[model samples]
Target: MRLFAWAALAACICAAPTLAAPQISALGTPAAPTAAASDPQAAAAVRVAMRQETLPPGGSLPEHRQSGERYLYVVAGRLKVSNLVTGEEQVVEAGKMAAEQPGDWHVAVALGAQAATFYVIDRGPADGAATTAANNDGN
Candidate 1:
């Protein structure tokens, strides 16, 4: 009886804040994706959750590879993405979206005064190893 009464009181208190604080927007949320929705290559397995990354003014790229394709949407500022696949480099500004296909060699440098933020939705790696941290994770 005591436990039940205490539980009811706790629930009531928890529910009381349902109408108080307003919702604040987060810059980005990165998680593993599910299902091979739009990518033709990822039609066979579940995709990983989307990833959101914010690169500072001097942010550089690491060597990594992913099995699924990448769809990157720039959320803030501008960036210079170099495609080493064909010796190509391009500038991607804010409000623009770009796709980096599988096995493409590239590097991204922040082109703005502050930081450049972007969100990427793509398939996860076939193996559990994270390529982004390949060189820096241990450091």
Candidate 2:
């Protein structure tokens, strides 16, 4: 009995290293669906992203006007955002936020020579889309 117990203990200890990390899945993967911040589509009626976005070192430009109301929440670093059409600019820090009005033209750049990240929450047209512009998701 003692020998069997010892053998089992040794086997268990040896097996520990072989244990693998589980493959985790969520409601969306940023732009895909798991988390809300990543899913711009959450505000479907307003016209937002259907998923999370990945930015490069320089950052990103507003591909399209958010069409409704939207806030950008910085996740990692700070960003310098410029409204191309209006020539308005602001510095957004980590854990801080910024916004874009409907039909506004904008662009974001990494601050301090470092990369920046943020999640966008877009709200428009009440809970449902009232017009084609607000409902044009992914636009």
Candidate 3:
């Protein structure tokens, strides 16, 4: 019985899908004119950019923020996030999404031993920086 179980486990392991390597790919960036009605003192041009980021276990982005909003879709593994502005923390698993409002500061930590990948859509001023360092308070 033990021998049979070992053989079965070996077969299962061999049949499992292999994890992919960490990588990043930029989709594209589109720009448009922003109306003064929406943002009284905003820049005339606005942009929307998309990209994918992958990280191995224990990888993390230090606390950061952007001039505009960012949306994230987790493709694999789990994302552990801590928001400094709201003092909230949560783990976003695969198949879920997380949104960060304009100028929302936060830290993201990848969870589990397996690798993780997520798609990020950033919308902001045409010339605004994609990400900026923020006060993480030692996170």
Each prediction's Cα lDDT score? 0.51, 0.50, 0.59
Winner by lDDT: 3
Lowest summed lDDT over 10 consecutive residues: which window, candidate 2? 21-30
> What are the RMSDs of all candidates, in order?
14.6, 17.7, 15.7
- TM-score for each candidate, following the candidate numbering: 0.55, 0.51, 0.60
TM-score-sorted candidate list, best first: 3, 1, 2
Candidate 2, residues 4-117, lDDT tens digits: the string is: 334433432232322421212111111222222344443222233322344667766554565444556676667777766667778877766566655655567776656776
TM-score of 3: 0.60
Q: Is candidate 2 or candidate 3 better by lDDT?
A: 3
- lDDT, candidate 1, equals 0.51
Better structure of 1 and 3 per TM-score: 3
- Residues 44-133, candidate 3: write the lDDT tens digits: 344556667888898987778776656667778998866677766778898766666445577788999977787766655567674544
lDDT of 1 at 95: 71
Q: What's the true lDDT of residue 119 in model 3?
A: 72
Candidate 3: where are CA atoms >4 Å away? 1-44, 129-139
Candidate number achieving the greatest TM-score relative to the actual structure: 3
